[model samples]
Target: MKAAQCSDYTSTNTYESVLTVQESVPTPNLEYDTPPAGFKNPMLVRVLSVALAPGDVRVMTGDTRELQGPPSMPYTPGGDVCGVVVEMPKESKKKGGWSFGVGDRIAARFVNKPMGMLGEYALVSPDVCDKVPESISNDAAAALVSSAAVAVIISDYIKEGDRVLIYGAGGGVGSHLCQAVRLKGASYVVGVGKDAKRLKSKPISCDESVNYTKDDAFNNKEWQDKPFDVVVDLVGGIWPKLVDQNQSEKSIVKSANQGGRYLTTTPDSAIFQGRSVWQILRVFLFPALWRATYTRIGFSRSYRPQYSYVIGLPSTSDIVTRTLSLAEEGKLIPCIDDSGPFPFTTEGVRDAFRLQASRHAKGKIIIKVSEK
Candidate 1:
């Protein structure tokens, strides 16, 4: 089978040196590598389309080398896939399962690991795989899995009439987060990002948009009267502290009302893609130091908002299913970047990764894995 394999650690975050097309990459056959002991057994899925996300980019670029370690040489590099079930063993059918079967169009995101979805065949289990609706395009289904799932999680924390602030609101997860929050009945949704035009281009349902490049991104007097009920920090680390690292950036966090929640999808070095070893270490260690510093400095932390990390849900199937249902109902839309879908060829995958690493994609990057 043909697969876009990561030949080695990417020299830079762009994945130019690491990703290459290779034939003869062994395809997964349920006969050899069965699903886990108790995971409803195995189902063989023929890759159709795949989506690019920051997590996939980080893995290829060695940003996660210290934590996830490097994939063995020639490892396939992808996380989200939309595919068709080519083979389903009778034993694979659990008595009270989702009834997944051959020919079912499925969308799944591989759990964080070296496991790849770029290959021709992917071994999927009931836990992470969800049957995508006929109304959803394969490209959209592939793009919806990971980011939409995170958006679902973030929305769960918001309540009706809540004033929500979504940082990085123009990117994949941020775009979905805006829509999800609106669906959750947020009274007002403010999207903050570097590109106001891109934010306005997507139907993200944000009530207002803030361009961080401007002098008063979120600190303007216009925002002073309206405090946020929830702050979703999709862009974390020093980004929140960029305008002013010495003290907490009021624009990023201080706007949150007391007792409100502050959520971040990225909580560690995960967001720092091959930037520098020192930078990665600082991010990994800063959380602890930040907590201690707050206590030692005797800083009045009474008004500190609840800080939490949006670790992906244990079972992504639920969110994936809900996202697809919303898509099928036309209540939600998958935000595929304007750059459009990349071909399934090796050069296509490489180019997609380069665009993703650039951190400026207006929406999800879709890879056309196979034709309908």
Candidate 2:
């Protein structure tokens, strides 16, 4: 099988040297006996399409090796995949517990693995897999698997008539998140990103778009009066920036209504640069500690919104099914980057990673691995 392999976490300029398209990578075998205790046995899939994620770039650059443990050399990197099941576990066929069979089109997000869904063939567990609807294209399905699952989880936090604010609102998860909050009946949605035009366009359609390059929406007077009820920060560094030495009260905290929920997907701005245990702990604990103690113990009664670092977990099959149904109904749009889905070649994959690393991609950067 042909697969894109990374030789090492080297400099981005040397991607051509570090990354290669190999012709004879061995196919993964299914373990019927050792199928992770309760999980179903793995299925061999014929890759159709794959989506590039921030994590892919992080891993390629050796940014997350300390936290996630380094991958073995010459590993394939991709998790969001849309593919067809070429072979199934014998037990799955005999027990009849599997929802899908050989030849079924599926989308899956493989977790905690080095050899991921970026090859001509890959093995996937059923737990994180979902059947892709006929209405959804392979590229779109690949794009949606991980990001949309996270968006759906985030949407659960939204309440009817709540005012929502999203940081990094033009990327993959951010785009899906924008639509997810709207679907959950948010009264208003404000999106902050570099690309204001795309954030306010169709699919994402944020009620208001803030270009972070031109303006500071957090400190702006315009949003001072209209505080948000829910703030989802996909980009880090905002929380620390919220504190102003000049102001008695943190003005950025004032951007959110009292008791508003502030959820962040990353611990800090250095997430991709490499995070120390202390740095990670500070980002995770500071807000919680402040909310729990500082507000109550201090002379001032002013309170910042509740803060949390949210990690997107592997979604259940039910959530995946619902997400696909929503996409099928045209209620949830899988936002692919305007420049992609890139072709599945060595150079094509390299370019896709370059776009993803640039952080300017309008939405999900997709790689078309094979024809549908």
Candidate 3:
């Protein structure tokens, strides 16, 4: 078990390190009793890896510590992982739970501590594990899970002939969201971002692009007349004071707020009152944000599922079969930014984090946690 370990912050130049993994690395046992937690999951590679999430960072926001410690300590940040299931909870035999077993190569999102896809071996609940779609490679599988889901979730309200716009439409999630909108056949797809470097690499159905760096972007001649029907805001910034209620019909804000300073998603209301636009705010933390709240706002007719959980995880079999078929067709293009050989062995993890933190680097970043 050769894994990278982030011992401290000073010596971070070494992005490559070797680790000795025991046959049984200490894993958090989540069984109710000793009913049958499971066996050791292993990686037969001297490795490192992590999924690139520009939004998520390894922070000590609330009672944080190193990955290894009490259950309450910060978990590793292995959000989007594509790895083999070497073992599973014995309780997996229970009826109507996650259908996973040993050796099933799967892709999933995890949050607890911050082992983010860089750990060679990880202990993940089956709920987070979905069988890798036959359509994507292991690396692509690891890269696209979180970003792809972001695309899928935002495109839910789309209609066949609707016009769509994606802000920050060049990053991983914004890029994929644009592609998904194209796949579903939106009438027009517009992409806006800070520059072209990010836009050049993304595979999107963008009919137009607007670079909002010209001092007053919103008041520009191009944007003044070309208002969109649906705007997908992926960057956290000061929202517009008012959006035309009549012109821009709907919107989805998919980025995380940069804390209290940025009054993100606040103007969704004025969309109707000021701009005559029917705005829809779609955040990824949970669907609960949209529900009863939307009903209270009196847009119940626009919301879907009638109740919540309507857009739950799709069938694993379906995701695997369909995505694999799409992959074969070459319809999916995941922009890859970085791949690593890591545990950060003091220097390894910090360097990886530094690269990941850069505002550049389009597509995804991955570390080779296990040999494919």
Candidate 4:
């Protein structure tokens, strides 16, 4: 089997230096029988397409080592996968009414160690895998596994007829979040990002687009005339500053109506990079503590919107099923970065990671691992 393997973390070097395509890597070995009490056997999957995300970059560059520990050397680097089941354990027939079989197209969040779906074949647990509908393409299915799941989870916060604002609204999760909120009955959606054209385009189709690169990015009169009922911050570092006493009336916080919810996916840092233990703790803990105290004590009512962090919980079968169902229903469309579906190669993978790390990708960065 061929696989793209990372020899070491890219902390001290470029991604090109550490990541390479090896022609002869061993395929994952699977147990035919379930012998363990708590463990379920993993199914072997033939990789079709994989998506790159900020978390993948975090792990590759050793930014998350302190929190997630180190990845073993020469490891594959993708978690969002769309693949076909090539092998299944005998116990699968008797377990949890398993419906997947060999050759069934599946999309999964493959988080097992060392071996990942970047290779020709990888092991996937049925728990995190869901059948990809015939209507969904492999690329879209791969992209949906992670970002759309987060968007689906976040959509639960939206209420009918609410006016919503989203930062980084052109990125993978952001694009999906926009559609999800619309599906949830938000009266209006505003997407903020560097690329206004993409943010205003189809699939995302934000009611209004604000380009943060401009000098008067957040100064739109519409924001003040009709304040947002909910603010989803995919870009971090804005919420803490918004709540500061030194903030002026022109602050982004002022654009949201008092008592509106401010939800964030990245509370600690917007950019993933190597950080010291103290840095990580202070960034996450301080804001979290302040949010809790401020809301509980009623300080948030007068000063700012209610704050809450959006933790990317482990993918569940229900979430995956809902995401696919939404996709099948055309309510949620996976937005692939315009620059990708990069070819499966050494350079292609590196370029995909480069685009993802740039934080400017219009949507999900996908690497086409194999043809369907």
Candidate 5:
């Protein structure tokens, strides 16, 4: 099985190296074919999976590492998969790591531990699988992981008609949130970040978009005194406070409802490091705190209120699923930064990551795992 192993498994620095497809001893003579239904277990099928940590910046790892591929050492950093199930687990019919027997078209959310999905075929856990909705294309589904899931998680915490402001609103998660907000009936979904071309490529629900490069960006004249109902901040570090003075009750919030985090359920590396212990703790403890705060403000004398909240929780797939349905209905469209000839060859996976590493890339980048 081919996989991208993290060399920095215990290091603060994050670097992954690709080893040769590990050929196991007493290897089962796995045949080459498709799974009976839509899952491929114990069989070889062409697949493409996204490796780990390819972006302008790494979350939790702190500081951005150059997005460069290793020279034939650490392979692909992929663990998330959108691919074909060429075989089914031999253990049981109801409980294979796939939906189909063989030759099935499917998409899966992998538990990044135990294995990865960066090559032709990977041994994986079937319990985490979700049938790719017919409405979702493979590229879109592939793009749906990671950033899309983050957006879905963040948007779930907001109230309908709430004015929302999003930082890091141009990359994958930001783009997904920008689109996902429409389903929530957001009063105003304002998106902020870089990649000017991507910002304009699709008509997102964000009522306005401001480039962080031009002038003070979020602090420009257009937003001198505007207060937000909710703030989903992905752009970290320096922040200049902005709130409506008249409201008196500051409602500027980020996913800080849980200390600037919405991804509490996903056990990514940050969680393992204990670096985000407080962050995750907030996800668990914030809801109660929020309920109390809301009630106190509602009945208190000091509750004049501008608008805003820090929302951070695991969003049910409802929003992403709904958006996908909307796409199917032609009511919404995902900006197609790039689509493909379906499953890519191993070399193609390498090239795709190389392109994805370029800081200018936009939209959901995908390597097809099979013919969809």
Candidate 6:
């Protein structure tokens, strides 16, 4: 089987040395990867398209391994996959409690394991697999699964008529999140990013857009006057830079409604690229810091708002299903960047990672793994 493999980790030129296409890698055995617990069903899928994510870039650069353990060797590093089901045992489907059959076009978010979708084939568990509708393109289907899953999960926190502010709202995940919140009946959806043009590129219906590079955008009187009820921050730790320097703290306090909910997906120093040992330590320590007694007590007393770090779980089959349905209905327009799909090659895969590492893509970066 020909596939791209992350054979080693690099400190400097991460993707250049870490990933390469190999011609003779053995195909995955569907029966071998399935668990003895009988909870996960295995589906051998002929890969069609796979999407690049920030997590894939982090994995390539070895940032995650320093804090967590290293990944298995010769790994394929992708999360979201759109593919055709080539084989699935009846017992596997029964055990996993899914009704899809062979040859069905499906999309899935695989668990954070060595096996990935950036290959000729991938073994997907049923819990993460959702049938992609005929109306959705392979690229869109591949791109939407993971981001839409996160949006669906986070939408649980949203309320009717809440004014929502999404940081990094111009990016792939943030754009879908904007739609999800809007569909939930947000009174206003304001997006904050460095590029106002990219932020407004898609008609995702963000009522207001902010370019943080502009002077004092966050604390600008317009935003301060219309305080938000929920803040969904996809960009972490950099929010302070977007606020007014003098009243950064007070402005954030004033901007949210009483008991406002603040959610961020990137809580670790991975967002910072883990440049130094201190940053690596921060990656491991951030979660602990959030749980600290004094930190918790102070936030509870002073802010009176709920702050949560969100992680998307692949086991949310219901969310995945609903997201696919929304995509088919044309309600969720995925913001795939202007740089369209990447061909399934060593160069394409490498370039995909570079685009992901840039942190400025307006939409999802997709790899066309196999021609349909």
User: By TM-score, who's the top model here?
Assistant: 4
When 1 and 3 are scored with lDDT, the better candidate is: 1
Comparing 1 and 2 by lDDT, which wins?
2
Write model 5 residue lDDT over 256-302, tens digit each, in one string.
33222222222212122223646544543454355335534444213
**Candidate 4 at residue 287, lDDT?**
71
The clash numbers for all candidates, in the given order, read 0, 0, 38, 0, 37, 0
User: In candidate 1, residue 148 scores what lDDT?
Assistant: 76
Q: Report the poorest 10 consecutive residues by lDDT, candidate 5.
A: 261-270
lDDT of 1 by residue, 1-372 (tens): 988888777747666666787788888777776432223465778989888888777766666675554435667777778999998755734456674668899988766453467878877665677888888889889878867777877888888988887878988889888888888899988888877766666578577788877855456555545556777777766334522522543443342235456677775334564356676547654674574345234433444555556665665367788888888888778988878799878788888888888887877888887887
TM-score of each candidate structure, all chains considered together:
0.85, 0.88, 0.64, 0.90, 0.62, 0.85
- Winner of 2 and 3 under TM-score: 2
Predicted candidate 3 versus true structure: per-residue lDDT over 1-372, tens digit per residue: 333333332223232432222233344333431211122221211122356564333231221222222233222344556777765665444357555556667766544433424455555545544666565677677666656665655566565765666666766666677777777767777767665545644465477666767543344455445544455556643244222322353223211120101112222221111111121223322333543245334433342112122233452334433443444576757656544533434454555456665544455666555556
Write the residue-wise lDDT of candidate 4 on 60-107 in tens digits. 777666554333567777877899999886465444666577999999
As a whole number from 0 to 100, the lDDT of residue 307 in candidate 3 is 19
Score each candidate by Cα lDDT.
0.72, 0.76, 0.47, 0.78, 0.47, 0.71
User: Who wins the lDDT comparison?
Assistant: 4
Off by over 4 Å in 5: 1-76, 91-101, 112-115, 201-205, 221-224, 238-327, 335-360, 369-372
Q: Predict model 3's lDDT versus the native.
A: 0.47
Alpha-carbon deviation at 263 in model 6, angstroms: 1.1
lDDT value, residue 124 of candidate 2: 74
How far in Å is the alpha carbon of 82 misplaced in model 5? 1.3
What's the candidate order when arranged by decreasing lDDT? 4, 2, 1, 6, 3, 5
Lowest lDDT sum, 10 consecutive residues, model 2, at 31-40
lDDT of 6 by residue, 257-329 (tens): 2656667777633355565668755764566356333324653434434556666474656777988888878
Please give the distance, in angstroms, between residue 22's alpha carbon in candidate 3 and its true position after superposition. Answer: 12
Instruction: List ranges where model 3 is wrong by over 4 Å.
Output: 4-49, 54-75, 93-100, 111-117, 195-202, 214-217, 241-329, 338-348
- C-alpha displacement of 46 in model 6, angstroms? 0.3
